[model samples]
Target: MTLRLAFMGTPDFAARSLAEIAAAGHEVVHVFTQPPRRRGRGQSEQKTPVHQLAEVLGIPVSTPASFRDPDVIAHFASLDLDLAAVVAYGQILPQAALYAPRMGCLNLHASLLPRWRGAAPIQRAIMAGDTMTGVQLQQMEAGLDTGPILLSETVRIKDSDTAASLHDRLMEAGALMWPRALAALERGSLEAVSQSSDGVTYARKISSDEARIDWSRSAEELSNHVRGLSPFPGAWFEMPGEKRPVRVKVLLAEPVSGEAAAGPGTVIEGLTVACGEGALRLVRLQREGKGAMDAATFLNGNSLPAGTVLD
Candidate 1:
């Protein structure tokens, strides 16, 4: 069945799904993404991943700031889309835009419905020590992610999984889920199941302030925090020096059995630090303005000696 589809998304995850959907032979007539924003070290304006991919695929693209304006809503309506698939589009669609398609909008959310249903689901789930997370395809509504689920598949959160790793796995899972969903839709057998209100939680956006490592927490907790923020806006701590404090990002850490009697944040031996409870051994870390390195290599070049306190 050749159905005219509109894709609304931004970011690499969404772009991956877009590629798979097109490859599956769906007619993605229009691609809507967020406006180009300045990014990177030079702060040059950059198009979103989805926008760039749409151009390569020769799909018409829209970057409207909002859809509440009647003209924007009318423009969307004129497309006469059979369905709209949205994944991390980063904008709240108005009721008019929600109803623009014949079958309404279906969203590819990173986490299972009713849990981690917001901007930073992937990061939040890891930080919360959740053992499992999944991708969900749901019918989008005016309410925030409070929609009926059409399809879902759970993925285990490995003990060694970081935010970057989990995100890649979920992206691949979501890419595969789209074709299965489309097949069901084509067969007219896809059912929308109302999401359970139980275990409802929101995964708020990760903030830089929150990325500062708090040594007062337990080692296990601190390890989870480090893993959750890995590879982006990394969890960090400051080490005292003769002249000034140097900020270092902790990319990977693990809780060790040994206990330290010293105060929290006290450096023990070989990248191990005392916390409020237990001890965490930093495995991989990065200095400000430097690339990441293993603990042994980082220690050989850096000057974090025993008894030094971290902030």
Candidate 2:
């Protein structure tokens, strides 16, 4: 029997799951996404990735400011959905909406349960230097990602993995796992385990304030920060000259053993800087408003002479 599903999501990550669900032969009754918001240089209202995809698939889309409206509730109830699959929906589901689905609501979260339980899990996991992170399908229970887990798959965090790269991998893995989970649901054989109180951590949203690179920290710490924030709101540092700091976004970096007595933020070599304990070689970087370039390109255009101080 084709499960009647109400798909709810807003971002690229969520769109992948919705595509997978449709390809799996489920009947998606409707899609609920956040309203279009102004974006880009023109500041024009733009639909989210999920919204675009829903339209392409000819599925009805709903963008409500809030779920408290009786009219919205009535419309949602009218769908008569069997289940709702939510991925990065960016809104709180009320109790009435939760119960509207016969099988309840299932969310595709980006991190392992009982750890990194809130927004920005991918960035948080890399920033904390965690060894492992994964995706979980959990039964929503009003609380913030505290629900029981329906299915999960673990992925190892590589030493050089960045948030963007890890996010792509997890999205693919989540799509692969969703079908099996849904099959179990259909067979009435799915099991959910309550999350443990231990290892609980909230992945607060990334802030621009935290993007500034503090060279005072150890090499390992700075390297983690760089990789964690890589590719978005990138970790940056101030360079000498120019009234404002020269924002350099680190795209790639690796820890290296060095005994430079230079202070933190001091440029010891062409592409290496001394940290609190060790040194790191900047592999790839980008100047503000410029495309990412190799170390040699960055040096040729904006050389950091030896002994130049950075922050």
- On residues 1-311, what C-alpha lDDT tens digit does candidate 2 reach at each position? 78999999999999999999999999998999999999988999999999999999999999999988989989999898999999999988898988899999999999998899888899899989999999999999989999999999999999979988999999999988878888899999999999999999999888887888788777888788988898987888878656777778888887778666798889988889998889888999999888999999999989698899987
Tens digits of per-residue lDDT for model 1, 106-177: 999999979998899999999999999999999999999999999998999999999999999999999899
Best-performing candidate as measured by lDDT? 1
* Model 1 RMSD, rounded to 1 decimal: 1.2
Local distance difference test, per candidate?
0.93, 0.90
Cα error, residue 164 of model 2, in Å, equals 1.2
* Maximum-TM-score candidate: 1
Q: TM-score, each model?
A: 0.97, 0.96
Pairs that collide in candidate 1 are none
